[model samples]
Target: MKLKLAAAMLAASLPLASMAFAQGTAPADLAMIDACLKTAEKTGGFGGACVGLVADPCIKAAKGANDDVAKWKACAARELAIWTQKTSEALKKVQAGGFTDVIQAVNDSQKTFAASRDRFCAVFDKIEPGMYPGDASYCRLRETANHSLSLIKLGAAVNEH
Candidate 1:
C-alpha cells in the first residue's frame, strides 16, 4: 500500500506528456495525465488543464481534427484507467489514516457517489449517437477522478487533526 501511494505521488510529479499533432501518434502513455492532476490539485481546481488532455491529442494523432470517433472512446478509456487507479489509491490512503469518523464518513460518501455515478452516467446514455457508451465512460471517468481528489483532500484534513 505504501508502495502504491509512493508511486502515485511520484507519478504525479512527472511532467505532462508532450502532445504531438501528427497523425498516428497518441500519447506514448497515460502518465501525462498524472502531471495534469497534480496541477489541478496545486491550483485548487479539478477540470481545467486536465480536461481533454488525452482525447484532443489522441484525435490529432489519429488523423488530425477530423480523426475517427473511435479515438475519442479509446482515449477516454485509457485516461479513465489512470484516474480510476489514482482515485482508488487515494481512497486507500484515507482509509489507513485511522480516524473512525472520517473513515465512516468517507465510506458513506463513497457509497452515495457510486449510486450517483450510475444515475449520472445513465443520463448521458439517453443522448443520441454513440454518446451513450462513450459519454457514460467519460462520465464515470470524470466522477471517479473527482472522487479521488476529494478523498485526497479528505486525507489531508485528517492529517490536520
Candidate 2:
C-alpha cells in the first residue's frame, strides 16, 4: 500500500515537473517577425517582401506558402484544428505517460499556431491599401491569414493550461 501511494504521488507530480520544461518561444518568434518586416521594408516592394517573409524560416519560422494562398489557408486551418483537438489528447497523455503526456501535444499546437501566424502575417502585409492587382484575392487572403493568427493566439493561450 505504501509503494502504491508513492507511485501515485510520483505520477501526480509529473505534469507539474514537465510544465517547468516548457520554454518561451515568444521573443524569438516576435524577433523573427520583426526582422522579416524590416527586410520587407528594405526590399522596397510589397509582393516580394511579403513572399520573402513567408519563405524565410528564420524570419517566419514556418513554411507553407508554396501552394496557392487559398490552398495554403485551407491546409493551415486544418492543421490548427488538429492542434486544438490534440490539447485534450495531451492532457490524457499526461495522465497516462507520467511526464511526456501533454508535452508533444502542446508543442505541436504551438508550432502550428506559430506557422499559421507567420503565413497570415506574410500575406497580410502584401495587401497594400491602394494596390490594384488582385485586390479581391488579396483581401480574401488577408482575411484567412487573420483567422490563422487568431487560432495561433488561442493555441498559445491553451498551452498555458
Best by lDDT: 1
**Per-residue lDDT over 9-39 for candidate 1, one digit per residue giving the tens place of the 0 to 100 score:** 4333221211121122334444577777677
Candidate 2: lDDT of 127?
Answer: 75
Error of 2 at 99 (Å): 21
Error of 2 at 135 (Å): 1.6
Give the per-residue lDDT digits (tens) of candidate 2, residues 15-128.
Answer: 321132133223443355456545744664332233222222322232334424443333233322222222333334333433343445534544344344445445543675
Tell me, by TM-score, which candidate is best.
1
- For candidate 2, the TM-score is 0.24
Give lDDT for model 1: 0.58
